[model samples]
Target: MPAATFEPPAHRGLLTESIARRLQNEIRSGAIPVGAKLPSERELAVQFGASRNVLREVLRRLEAQHLIEVAPGRGSFVIDQSTADARSYDALYRAGRPTVRQLIEARIPIEVEIVGLATSRATDVQIEAMRTANAAMIAATDPVVKARADLEFHDTIAAAAGNPVLRIMLSSIGGMMFEMMLRSNSDPSIAEPGVPHHPEILEAITARDTDRARHHMREHLSLALRTYGPDLDLSLDVMAANHIETLLHRRSTP
Candidate 1:
C-alpha cells in the first residue's frame, strides 16, 4: 500500500520552527535523551501540533545538526551531540545551540556588565523600551511570549549599554537563549522566582545606580541556574554569589 500524505500546515515555516525549538529543548533537557527513539512521525506530528511534512522538516533539521539520526526503518533517535557539523547546522544560531545552563553562565558576566553600562548610559527612550518589554512579560499568559519578553528586556539593556560589540555578542546567542527561556518560563517553579527581578532590575537601571544595578542583576542572575535543581553543579552561581557579597562589601567600605 502507498503511504498516506499530509497536507502541510498553512504557516509551515512557523510550525516547523516551533516544533524544532520544542524538540531541541526536549533533546537538550534529556526528556528525549541521547539514544532514545523518537515517537513515530505521525505521533510526533500530533504531539507537536504540526503536519507530517512539517515534522519531517524538523527531523531533517535535527539530523543535520547532529542532534538526532534517522534509521531507514527503525525510526529517529536522539544523538549524543558529540560534535557539531557546521556545514548543516551553522546558520541561524543553530551551529551549537547552548543549553539553558550554558546560557546562564554567559548571562552572568555579560549581562552584569551590560546592566552596569546601561545604568549610567541609557537614555530615557531606552529605559522606556525596557519598561515596555518588562510590562509585556508581566502581562503575557503564554510561555513563549513571556520568554521572548524576558529576553527582550535584557536585549534592550544591551542596546542601552551602547556597546555594539556587547549587543552583538548577546544577539549571537539570542535564539538559543529564547529556547532556554521558554523551557524555564514554562515551569511555574522556576519562572515565578525570576519574574519579579525584572522590575527591580529595571528600576535600578532607571535610577542610574551602577552598583545597585549590577548588584540586582547579579542576584537576579544567580537565581537563573535554579532550574538545574539542587545537585546541579552551580559553581558559577556560587562565584556569582561571591561577587554579590563583594559588591555588598564595597558598600561597607569606608
Candidate 2:
C-alpha cells in the first residue's frame, strides 16, 4: 500500500493537532490498517511540510492515546480498532471523566445559579468581559474559535458570580465541557439552532434580571440536551460496551 500522506489546507493553526486528527481518521477508516508501519519520521515531516520536532510531538500524542505504537528500531504502527476503543474507555472511566450527558446535567443547575448570581453581582468590568466574549463568539468564523468563545462567555459569567467555590467547580469540568462543545459544533444540524440562545442569555444577564437570567440559562441548557441527547446516549452506550468487551477479552486471555 502507498504510504498515506497528510495535506492540510493553508492557514489552519494547531498544525500538530490537525495532523493527529487526520492520522486518527485514517486509522479509524482503515486506510492505515492495524499493525501497518507508518511512514518514517523524516518522510512524514517532509510530506506534512512540518518540522521534525512538530511531527515527533504529534507522534507522541498519538502514542499516548494508544492510537499508534512507536518502536525505537522500527516505526509507528496503528493499533487494532478494538484495542483503541478499549483504551479510550479505560482512559475516560479511569480518569473519572464524566460522560457528555452527566456533564450537561451537572452544568445546568450549577450554571443557572451562577447566571443568577452574576445578574446581581456583576460589576461593569466583569459584564464587559462577558460582552467581549459574546462578541467574539458572534464574530468567530472558525469552529474552534467559536467554541472557545462560547465557553469563555460562560466562564466570564462564573467569574462575575464572585463565588470562588463555584468558579473552581466549573473550572474543574471546563475541559470536558469544551470537548463536548467542539463535538456538537462540528455538526451543523446541532450547532445552527443553538447560536441565537447565547445572545439571549447574554441579554438577560446584562439586564441584571435574575429570573430572566436563570430562565434563559436553563432554556439554553435544556435546548442543548434536547438537541444532543441522542448522540450523547449513543456515545455512552458504545463506551460502556467497549469497556465490557475489554474486560471479557482480559478474562478470556487468562
Error of 2 at 166 (Å): 1.1
- Candidate 2 residue-wise lDDT, 137-220, digit = tens: 778765557768888988999999999999888876664566566555545667788777777877887787899889988887
Candidate 1, poorest ten consecutive residues by summed lDDT = 1-10
| Each prediction's number of clashing residue pairs | 0, 0
Q: Which parts of model 2 have CA positions greater than 4 angstroms off?
A: 1-97, 235-254
Q: Quote the positional error of residue 154 for candidate 2 in Å.
A: 1.3
Instruction: State residue 9's C-alpha deviation in candidate 2, in Å.
Output: 6.8
Judging by TM-score against the true structure, name the best candidate. 2
Instruction: For residue 248, give model 1's deviation from the true position in Å.
Output: 42
Could you give the C-alpha RMSD of every candidate to the true structure, in order shown?
12.3, 10.6
Q: Evaluate all candidate structures by whole-model CA lDDT and list the values in order.
A: 0.71, 0.71
Q: How many backbone clashes does candidate 2 have?
A: 0
